[model samples]
Target: MDVKKVLIAVDNSTCSEKAARVGYETALQFGAEVALVNIVEPVPANVNPDLTLAPVFLETYDNSKENSDMLLKEIELKFAQGTKTTYLSTVDTAAHGIIKQAEEWAADLIVIGTYGRTGLYHFLMGSVAEHVARKSACPVLIIPNKWEED
Candidate 1:
């Protein structure tokens, strides 16, 4: 298939770094435009139920957005330098945000990394890559966290 646009989903994890590298290489090979996206899930304010922690939650959300933007910038510089690239930072669930960005940008392919959480942790947190692969309209490339096993 012809890939004219590539969307890469990244986070603060090393797994994401690996995925970004692979995605960048693939995009370069295909001569495709690239977009890097980072999702910042909003901090839930219902943990206290009394609204007393609203300010703290707001601050946490702000910090998350800031960090996400920084991460996207760093990934773009490291992986997509000298290439046409777009950086996107959005507030949403990770999988949903990535899918949305890909769809909106009309991406031909999506690349993401799995955290490789297994057993109880996997069951509890679910897999963002799995969700995106299942729900995305276009092709998805999921890079496993193999270094974690070493």
Candidate 2:
């Protein structure tokens, strides 16, 4: 398939760093444009829908957005220098946010990292990478956290 556009999903984590490197390499190999996306989950509805408009929530949201922007910029500088790239930061559920960005951008492929959480933690938190892989319209490449090998 012609992968003209690649979406690299990242977070402020070592796993994401590894994924960023792999994703950049993949993009370089394919001569594809890249877009870095970071998802900042919004305050849950159970936290009080009214609080969504409160100053506290707004401040938290602003902080999250700023952090996401910084993370995306840093990843771009470190892994995707000299490549045509875009930064996408959104406040939504992680899986949904990544999927939405990929669909909106019409990405040809998606590269993401997984924490490899298992057992109860996996059950509780779920896997963003898995969700994205299953839901994305295009292909997905998941980078596992291989700290020992690194």
Candidate 3:
């Protein structure tokens, strides 16, 4: 698809490794650079319905970003097909963060793995990859999770 820049969203899972390899190969074939992205989902605040909880959630968000950075680094080390990697960690909603990273980097392709949820559960909870594909400006490629193999 004439990719000039690609973002591979990694989560330290086996599915992520496949997406990383695919992104790397596509980047190499298109003379593009690969950006490794990790989005930290902030932990929900402790509910009291009595006191303010934003402060607690704020701390959780900060910690989540740091954790995401560590995961991104670990994933980068596992990248085999290409050497080009830029890491990005954001304390935002997963889908939003991924889309923002792709936009900021001017990426031509967004590659990620689907958890492969189905049935009523999938309809109710939604999925990050599907959200990105529906909203992203660039092409979004979602590699189905290798459940049987991994």
Q: Which candidate is the best by lDDT?
A: 2
Against the hidden reference, what TM-scores do the models get? 0.86, 0.90, 0.82
Task: Rank by lDDT, highest first.
Answer: 2, 1, 3
Off by over 4 Å in 2: 44-52, 147-150
Report lDDT (CA) for all predictions: 0.89, 0.90, 0.83
Residue 126 CA displacement from its true place in model 3, Å: 1.0
Clashing pairs in 3: none
Query: Regarding TM-score, does 1 or 2 come out ahead?
Result: 2
- Can you list the residue pairs that collide in candidate 1? none
Where does candidate 1 stray beyond 4 Å?
Answer: 46-58, 147-150
User: With candidate 1 superimposed using the best TM-score fit, by how many Å does residue 85's alpha carbon deviate from the native?
Assistant: 1.0
Order of candidates by TM-score, top first?
Answer: 2, 1, 3
| Candidate 3, poorest ten consecutive residues by summed lDDT | 74-83
The sequence of per-residue lDDT tens digits that candidate 2 reaches over residues 30-123 is 9999999999988743345664466778788889999989998899889886889999999888999999999999999999999988999999
